[model samples]
Target: MLKQKAGTRSPDLTVVEMRRALAQRIKLLAEKPGEHPTAIPGLSLYHRTTPTPCFRASYEPGLSIFVQGRKRILLGGTEYLCDDSSFLLSSIDVPAQSQILEASEKTPLLSIFLRLDLPTVREVLSRDDIPESPPSTHRQGLVAGETTVGLIGAVMRMLELLDTPEDIPFLGALAHREILYRILRTPQAERLRAIATSGDLGQRTARAISWLRENYAKPLHMEDLASTARMGVSTLHHQFRALTAMSPLQYQKQLRLQTARQRMLMDGLDATTAAYEVGYESVSQFSREYSRFFGLPPIRDVKALKNSNTALVSVA
Candidate 1:
């Protein structure tokens, strides 16, 4: 967690004011419940008017700042609570179940999501003035921390740029760098640093994860994955689980299940078709696993999702 500097005055009042200001901006930009992509590259706003059921989703490498309300994210067996005062940082792509815990029509859940730029992170790490943190034995890909005033201010400036289209081409890059630099100053910097540093085991593990994400449909061979990460099979398994909270096989199963759900939901594919498309050889096996993961059969789950979306649209 990021701590306030020594001898510095408490920033409670300033944080509250800035949070309210940021929430107003998000309300103006979002205008409805859902993820809203901004003109600025890699920046997105999220607003939710009501609490939601736990839903499966994939999070990429990014910073998620919760400016209002509350959310719950379940990664593996661990649960993370993100409220107005918290931020969730993901250093690698991982699957999780998330739900909105607090939101209402009067005060919706508001947040910001920004994809991390690897090049910029590496550039910041190259600086000599930055202090180094000792290596952690338990490397986790997803972490939660308290939101700092400096981080909130930087995000507010990023949102301000949306009102000036011309400034985005120039000032946008500066804002991105500033946000990263602010994060790097915090203890959470080690997570980003581990992945950005070349020749690091974390970086190698990230390579293997990237491969899994892109080629989930392909048959997964431990040897191939080990070769991709340039580590022995056992070492790769240990490092992979340490970072992702799941083994390679478990991770691939999640990817397949999630993609299959998407195909069925968006493309009107049937269970059998979607199953085969996502590398599941047997439709029955896919149905069994899908039921276990999502708490409903494939057909029923898709129907529920479609109905929920339709209701949301009608309400809007």
Candidate 2:
């Protein structure tokens, strides 16, 4: 697990005010205690009345800010605990397990997900006034950082625009850019920089990830993936694992399982059919892997997931 930053400043009065405003805005915008789409594009609000189960889901490239409760996100064997004082950012698509750890009927877990825009990030990076590139670090795609007053204020502004639909067209994009700028100024900036740079090792590894996502049903070939990434096999493996916290093969397995699970749960595909559809050759192997990943047999797991009271809605 990543250690929390030492000597980090506690929330000041401004930050406290921002957090309170964010919580109130989310509560107002969220019609009920569930996820809801926001007026601004790429923004989603989640309101939970109680603690949640450890839900295994794929986290896309985005930012999640907690304003009222806490969440524990498990990536690989590492667990990141984030609450009202911090924020979580995922610069690339990753399979992660997350659960709302602190909430109640009185003060539910109120959070917001802001889908990061790569194009806007690149636009911000292109400016000559942008800060000099920091030394490269082999950080994982998922990160937790202290939430600054600026970031929360920007989010509050975006939420404030919800009541004025006409202003969203004019001000939403600017607010989004400001949010990105605030993120770029944080320690999370280096990871975002790696993704934004065109020829960096991180970006090349991202290409391989993209290919796997689009062609997960196809057999994985290391040489082909390396060739696609324009890197040597050894470098590809090293950088891919460093950026994603999993080897290429392991990453592909996650994609396969997640895709298969979604197929079974949402599309009502049977275990055998979903397995083959997701490129699993052996039914037994698929079942074993599925059981390990999802904690139950395919049929049973889907039944439990559907029957669960937890509601997650992603506008992205």
For each candidate, give its TM-score against the true structure. Answer: 0.92, 0.93
The alpha-carbon RMSD values of the candidates against the true structure, listed in the order shown, are 4.1, 2.1
In model 2, what is the error at residue 26, expressed in angstroms? 0.8
Among all windows of 10 consecutive residues in model 2, the one with the lowest summed lDDT is 307-316
Note the residue pairs that clash in candidate 1: none
Count the clashes in each prediction: 0, 0
* lDDT for each candidate structure: 0.84, 0.82
Per-residue lDDT tens digits for candidate 2, residues 1-316, read: 6643312676678878878887888888885877787778989998877777887667778888888887788776567788787788888887777777898888888889999888888999898877865665537888788888888888888888988899999999999999988988876788888887878888888889889989988999999999999999999999888877789998999888888888888888999999999999999999999899778999988888789844332311
The whole-model C-alpha lDDT of candidate 1 against the native structure comes to 0.84
- Backbone clash pairs in model 1 (N, Cα, C under 3 Å; residues 3+ apart or in different chains), count: 0
Q: Find the candidate with the highest lDDT and give its number.
A: 1
